[model samples]
Target chain A: MSGRAIVVTSGKGGVGKTTATANIGLGLASQGKKVVLIDGDIGLRNLDLILGVENRVVYNIVDVVSGRCQPRQALVKDKRISSLFLMPASQIDEKDAINTDQMRDLSAQLKEEFDFVLIDCPAGIEQGFRNTVAAADEAIVVTTPDVSPVRDADRVIGLLQSSLGEPQLIINRMSMDMVKRGDMLDQQDVLDILAVRLLGIVPEDEAVVIAGNKGAPVVLNGGSPSGDAYGRIARRILGEDVPIPELNGHNSLAKRLGRILFGR
Target chain B: MTLTELIQRIQHSFGKGGSKDEAKSRLLLVLQDDRLGLTAEEKEALRQDILEAIRKHLKIDAEGFTMEFVSSPTDQNKMHVSAPVQVGRGPANFSK
Candidate 1:
């Protein structure tokens, strides 16, 4: 079967789009699903660093697009999962240097070989963003439970709907304590503004930073809560009915959160 | 307001961000003056009625539009509905 191409994008930066893409690609590949992660943020690429494969990159997407190498040759295989691969972006400042038609053709070719192709989009709705989303069959908009992110997400969602399709929402960096105290915007507050299907909600986890710093995905860590969350997201991506684990900063604030977020 | 005025109101609402193809339409239709004390069914009817009125007024096709009556994101007394021109068709598949 041809794989699905998904672009992970958020209008605003620093909302965990790269982390989520890396983890999702890693998680899917770990389950024996062939996956390839693409970093579409040219000149400011970081998906390779997050995947712990930066040092192994010889040719990048730029190389592949420029006909310097084949798409398969440019892919750097992940040591942890044989089925997972990373296609790094170029380091040059020319974001529009790569041919968009070539990128789309590369995505089409990648879709034939891999079961899932994840593209980590650059922040903001610019050329790089257009390049990232040009070939995606679906989109996932990551946002924090805040007013500004939600507002930006709404604008992004509106744009995606006009072209790509119905983009799903993923709430990242959720602090349950803040939600319980009503200090922050809860899931309902986000859904209230951006009307979209709820994909998965990842709790605010410090392990993300530590793992990224160490050049490893936290999903491989058995004791990591965010790892478990990513695993569930990956399984759900595979059409599994995995129940979302109610993770918070510590204890069981889920029942109250269910009432608050879903109005149950 | 009368139904004709209400339809004009809905048209005016969609005209705010009315960009050609790039900026799809979003409408925030609020029903004021509930002093009529309409029943729940009546209120629901009016909501659907307004949607039909807008569709008829706007001359939109069937497949490319979606109108949702949602609780207002800001004003308590208002309802919001964003009608972006739907592009692709199929169930949403969310990736990690």
Candidate 2:
């Protein structure tokens, strides 16, 4: 059977679609699945950098689509996992270099060879957005706890639903302390807006930033709380029955907020 | 803003996973308030205006939901709108 192609997308910028893509792709490969990570952001590509393979990128996705290189030649392998490969996007080329038809065909080709194909989509519902969505079997919408990100995520989910069906949600960079203080929206709040299945909720951990700076994903540190969160998400993707634990310890404070949401 | 004040500002019953019907209901709550002090007919106009804005904001067609304003016996200044939001697809509505 051909593998599944899932796109990591967010309509809003800087919501960590690329970061989640790298981690989840690596996480899946660590499970002994052959995974291929595609940087579908075109001109503003960063998946290569997040995977710490930027220095290794020579041929990109555009090179493959434009028929300049075959898929095998464009593949950048990472030794971190058993068999994880990357298809970097062109940095100098524009978004116009690729379209939905080409992407759809390319994804079908990749799926035949890998166990999983993950595309890190660009922000906004433009050409790059449509191109990534065109090839996916399902989608993962990433969002932060703020208003604008939620709003834009809602917009993206709506688009994905019309084309790709309902997309699972990943609530990233959540501040449990703020949620306890009633300052930031909790996972339930975001689920309220999108009404999508909650895939996983990743808490705000500074270790994520430190790991990113060192060109490593937090999920590599099985002991880190944030890594634990992504690991759960990855297992969930493989159809493991994983329960989302209550992230904030002081549930006492948000108790009132939860009750009020239910009733008097 | 003070942490308490910020919390108070955001402490609305907006998120708790259920259905899109919840969003339509919440949108109605956010659309109109008695502070505007418009007449019933004027309030309906404002409601329609806000509905248009919501459709544009969500990038969805108007058919995503339906809304109607209902009369409230207790508060003359307040109007209640009940809405049922339906996604395009069924249980596949969450992920397909």
Candidate 3:
């Protein structure tokens, strides 16, 4: 079957691109779709750790591209999900370990087997970013509510729009409390600046941190709000019209401020 | 002035606000410049070229020269460049 290859990226670091990739991949696989999560970060691989399959990684994407091992041999199957797998990155090598051509070939080969190929792209618009974006048919731009990340996300969105068309956005780590208090950028603030299709907004939850510490994705835990958000995002990716609920509490002042600043 | 301080001044001119408003305004200004992909050096060079072209006819105050990018009032997607030149009284206006 001709599958979809999507690259999950944020221009800035520490914005939870790997976590989103792991959860979204697991969420899709939970629906019995064959999903392969590829860690395109190369030397700074973390998707395997987030998916709790680090120990299972023997041969990585670099090894597969360098002809040391076949792609199937390099894939580390998910422990809980039967249809989920991970193509881990090479931790020892640099971001240049795999070039654009090699990544495209690998992604195309995997698309024939897996229903979804979720590539966890590295931060910044460097070689790693180029390689991952080059392999994808679609893109998902993840960002937080902060200033630097939002700016970088805007830049990444511009780049993605020129190449892969308009990428859907995932606003991660949104603090509902702060939004209500007018201390943080709400979904409207982010959407106004980015001007992209909103995929999902994962609320700030302690369960995400705990899941990361345990090396298991929060979506596998099944109780956290962030996990539910990821599941909804996966559904949306499958052409389901899942509405993103309003996270901002009814604060008229904040709404006024949003209207004044964002002109929503 | 640094771009951050300029943005803060612009936001302050908008009157009462919160952290969210400040951030959105700041991002709006920054992303406009970012989308243009023009560096400060490029802008300065462009300013110099404009000064040279205008100096052929009218006198210009090079020291009082200012060029900056401001958010457009009508369209959020567009940017307006504000460069206020002080017309020099002296013919040369050179200290040397």
Candidate 4:
């Protein structure tokens, strides 16, 4: 059977749709599944950079759509994972350079060869977003715990309900300390408003930024909490009942006692 | 009788006390159905209409009470009317 196409999108910018796409692709690929990550951001593409395959890009999705190269020639295989491949977007081109039909055809072609096809969608509910979602079987929406992000996510959810169907939600960059201090919105509060099934929650880890800067996804680094969370998300996608990770810092009994005594 | 007095008389009849929560919940339900921006005068009319409507449906006496209208974030064009129908009490102390 053909593989499933899943689009990672967010109505607001800086919500980590790209990061989630990269990490999830890596996670799935690590499980011995053939995965293809598509850079649907088009003109402002960064999936290639994040996956650390930027320099090897001989052709992009536009090249395949315009018949300059076949789909196989456009796919850049990741150095670390044999099962994972990336279809990077062209930075110099405009958003209108590629159409939805092309994306649909490309995704259909990829589905034949891979076990999973993940599209990294751009922010905003515009033509670019439309193009990315056109060929997908399902969608994964990424949002932060801030009110603005949640509000934007609600709008996106409404749109998805009207356009696609019920899209799963992923809460990204959640800070447990802020939530404990009542300074940030909690997961339940977001779920109450959105009313969608929770797929995963990624904590606010500094390692994510460092990994992005290094052009390496944190999912490959076993020590990173966010990496482990991404790994669990991948397993969940593969039909494994993986429990969601707890975001609070793990403290020993001595530390807890010390905090209670000192009121720290 | 005044609308406030009628509501109070109804509240007094339902003597099971603690009618404040019931009244608030009932008014919220009605306001949800109204789906319009109800003004103070409109709200007063609604209060009377609701009491009369309830009276026609059931048997009860209402006393000292008030009905307030608020806004809902989900449906911006509608008003949420909350009526605290006090029954058989000195006064229905609605916080707001």
Give per-residue CA lDDT, model 4, range A149-247, as digits (tens).
Answer: 766776777778876799999999988665543345556656755678889999899999999999899999998889988998999999999988655
Candidate 3 deviant stretches above 4 angstroms: A252-264, B1-16, B41-76, B81-96
**Residues A43-137, model 2: lDDT tens digits:** 88788887888888889999999999999999999967759999999999988799889999999999999989999999999988998999999
lDDT of 1 by residue, A1-264 (tens): 699999999999999999999999989998999999999998887998999898999889988988889998889999988999999999874888775687788899999999999999989998888877887889999998765566667668877998899998889988866554344555655665567877788888999999999989889886787888888888888889987654322224555344334432
Native contacts kept, each candidate: 0.04, 0.03, 0.36, 0.00
Q: How much is the lDDT of residue B43 in candidate 4?
A: 65
Taking the tens digit of each residue's C-alpha lDDT, what string does model 4 give over B1-96? 577655543333322122333433443444333434356687678788876765554434456334444433354334333433434556543323
Q: Pick the candidate with the highest DockQ.
A: 3
Segments of candidate 1 deviating more than 4 angstroms: A245-264, B1-96
Pairs with backbone N, CA or C atoms under 3 Å apart (clashes), candidate 2: A189-B15
Q: Label model 4 with its docking quality class.
A: incorrect
> Which candidate model has the greater lDDT, 2 or 3?
3
What does DockQ come to for candidate 4? Answer: 0.04
Deviation from native of the Cα of residue A122 in model 2, angstroms = 0.3
Q: What are the models' TM-scores? A: 0.71, 0.74, 0.82, 0.74
Best by TM-score: 3
Please identify which of the two predictions, 1 or 3, would achieve the higher DockQ against the true structure.
Answer: 3
TM-score of chain A of 4: 0.93
- What order do you get sorting by TM-score, best first? 3, 2, 4, 1
Per-residue lDDT of model 3, residues A142-250, tens digit only? 9999999999998899889988999999999998767765678888778888888899999999999999999988888777899999999989999999999988645
